[model samples]
Target: MKALVTTEDSGFGLRMADVPEPEPRPGQALVEVRAVAVNRGELSMMAMLPPGSQLGWDIAGTVLRPAADGSGPAAGTRVTGLADGAGWSELAAADTARLTPVPDDLDWTAATAIPVVGLTALYALRHAGLLLGRTVLVTGAGGGVGRMAVQLAAASGARVVAWVGSAERAKGLRELGAAAVSTYDAEETGPVDVLVDSVGGQVLNRAYRLVVPGGKVIVYGNTTRSELNLPVDWGHARPGVQLRYVHLFHELPAHPVTRDLGFLVQRVADGLLDPQVATVAPWTDAEPALRALAQRQVNGKVVLTI
Candidate 1:
């Protein structure tokens, strides 16, 4: 099978290579990957991967075989889920517990775009204890996770404030249910009951200060990759405010990832949640697709069709 693997070169650090197909374990299913979504997190760690290492995590495909333990959906079921590795390949062995059935009418690209980001947004909101009538602020609102976060939070009856880098990117956030959309540099005069910060650095610092007392700030991705410098007196000023860092991989076991993913999939099927796809390119065009993501040229998820 051909997969996008790590290369020795700098800049995106990926190349197509033929690799052995994955073998399903007792609780895993072998999937014939139809499409894969590109994420900024995977691209950021590309240079750190050993040469020829398989990349990508989110994928949508048909199950060629069911789990040996007979714990999941049957063979031939179309599903979308996360894989530990080699998700960019034509085949992947996914844990049956984490897989969610994709709706028959959903496009493979759209389905592939949901897993990682959708789960992240859901988990973050849950961590923040978001409630109806609460004001929730989502940073990097134009990105995949941010867009999902905005929609999910709004659907939960929370007032959603979307923060993006540019007005152009903020164009459709309101339609996603965001009560307000503003640039990252804009001042947030009102306090929010919960905050989801994906774009660490100054934006995160600003978001931290916007949280109301006893509210939580869930820090997930650090797209800016810069150090977060909070005020020296923050602890005294916001004594009960909780600061939590969310890493989906670490929280997968404790949380019902598959169940939550399934619910999100259903929402997408019902047109309640949109996995806004910025680009859908052939698998052979992985290089350009990855380059677009690395350069932050895409507004939402980028799916590469196999």
Candidate 2:
């Protein structure tokens, strides 16, 4: 099958040739690929790996085969979920337990964008305690995870305030149920019961001031400037709010209850979790999308259709 391979010089190149189709190796399943999301984590992995290595996790496909031990996905189910590797192809293999069924109404491009971002949003909001009557501020509100964060917070009944970098995204954020939209600096003036930080650097420091004394602050991704500084006043007085940062991969298939990928996938099928896709490119054009992701030119998750 034709697949996009990372080139010798840290870029994606199409390799239209015979590549071994992945098969379920005990506790795994083989999926007939439909679409996959291009995420920052995959981009960062690309930067660290040698040429021709594939990197991606979110996949929307069909279960073509299940393992003999009956530990893999049942064959012939339309699915959308997370996996470990070989994600940029027409066929991929993953542990069956990792697969999640996709609702028939949603397209693969949308399905491909759900897993990691939605899971991160779930963790961030879960950390924020009693979300129903709270007010939550989401920084980098327009990006993939941030966009999902806003919706999840609102679904749990939190009054959502989204801080977006561009004015154009304000309308979309509001449509997703954000109560208000503002720039990072401007959004800091409001009272926040919880803060979800996607952009790091000064924006994160700025968010620290908005949280109510007993509130919570969760940082799941750093999309802004990488090097971040903490405000001295954040810990200066009062029994300060809780500050916790997370990486989605760190908790996957672990932590017992909260790490339930099955629950997450069920939510996707039920429309409780929504995937926001910024762009979709065929496998042949995935290189451009990868370049755009690396250049920080993308607005949300980019989907590569196989």
Candidate 3:
């Protein structure tokens, strides 16, 4: 199997080489890689660690085999979801309990887009009680998770007011179902029932005053700031209104876990969701895409064609 291997622990090394195929462990599934996407987590990981670590998380592929522990995807099936690492490879392993089935009609590019970003959006919208025609504002509305949230919340009957940093994205955000699209400005203000924040720091701090009383704020990823900040008093003084940080990985497998990646896969299999691929590059070109994406030059998800 050929894989993107990190040769050093620091942020700047990646080499493609032949590695042994991974065998499925009990409770795990083996996937023949098709497509994978990039995220800031991967960038930061590479920056912080030595090379030799496989760097990838979002993946969509087919189940070649499931572990003998009854983890098979009914033997073979098209599926997608989060993975531990080694995503930039021809093969990978994930717990059978974590893999989700993709829609038969969807391509791997689209299938690969939904899991991490989709789940984050799902959790945010649900936590905010998105229905009832509530007005919600999503920061970074044209990005991966933001676009999904915009579409998902709009589909659920929410009147959405979204913000993006660039004017070019405003039109698309509107097309995707934002009731209103505004250029993110610190002084801007509007009443909202929920705010799904992916871009943080100043944008997040400014968003504090926008939600209605008793409303909730869901914080997931921080794209704009490495050292994110919030006004403790921002949401504190408003009784019944609270702010909570939600990481999909942490919440996806919470205790008494009745739901997992399979839930997201079910939605995908049912045609309720799709991942938007911003760009697809071979593993050799991953670095430039990762750099551009990490720098915000790329919108939506970046997939690696294995």
lDDT score of residue 292 within candidate 3: 75
Candidate with more favorable, higher TM-score: 1 or 3? 1
lDDT of 2 by residue, 205-259 (tens): 7777777777788988787657867667676542667888877777664543223
Superposed by TM-score, candidate 2 places the C-alpha of residue 158 at a distance from the truth, in angstroms, of 0.4
Where's the lowest-lDDT run of ten residues in candidate 2? Answer: 253-262
How far residue 184's Cα lies from its native spot in candidate 3, in Å, is 1.4
Predicted candidate 1 versus true structure: per-residue lDDT over 132-155, tens digit per residue: 999998999998899999999999
Per-residue C-alpha lDDT of model 3 across residues 66-172, encoded as one tens digit per residue: 76788547556888876667677788887765677766877888778777787778777777763767878898887788888888888889888788888866656
Q: Which residue pairs overlap in candidate 1's backbone?
A: none
TM agreement with the true structure for every prediction: 0.96, 0.90, 0.88
Model 2's lDDT to the true fold? Answer: 0.76
Flag regions of model 2 displaced more than 4 Å: 9-17, 255-273
